[model samples]
Target: MKRKYNPHGLPPWLRSIRNVCGQFIVPICIFQGIRTLILPSILDVLLLFLLIAAVIAFQFEMI
Candidate 1:
């Protein structure tokens, strides 16, 4: 039987490293949009923070 594809959807709560990292992609993209609209210089700092948040999220998910 063919299964439905769910490339972007995840369970409500993060359950794994891939889940956490994957879920973050869209928000990071959206945040970039908002940041660029306000201040281009802030994008770099925002991205750095996103990276740190992503690392922490991944670490928690791994536990």
Candidate 2:
């Protein structure tokens, strides 16, 4: 059987860190996106992609 996921199952410190990251991930994604648009380097694009994925993961509580 598949078990349910619970955010409270996490330790206090880890949960706090996840909360902080969830709050900041959007702005960081925006900044990275703008930076990628202006600069368009390979690394910048890669970073932007990673940041976007992180945003998705955080939003869906898949992290």
lDDT of each: 0.62, 0.93
Model 2 pairs in collision: none
Which number leads on TM-score?
2
Q: Tens digits of per-residue lDDT for model 2 on 1-63?
A: 988888999999999999999999999999999998887999999999999999999988988
- lDDT score, candidate 2, position 57: 90
- As a TM-score, model 2 comes out at 0.89
| Candidate whose lDDT is highest | 2
Candidate 1 local lDDT, 1-63, one digit each (tens): 986645346655534656656677666767666776677776566785676566665555532
lDDT for model 1: 0.62
Model 1 RMSD in Å is 10.2
RMSD of each: 10.2, 1.4
CA shift at 22, candidate 2, in angstroms?
0.6
TM-scores, all models, native as reference:
0.38, 0.89
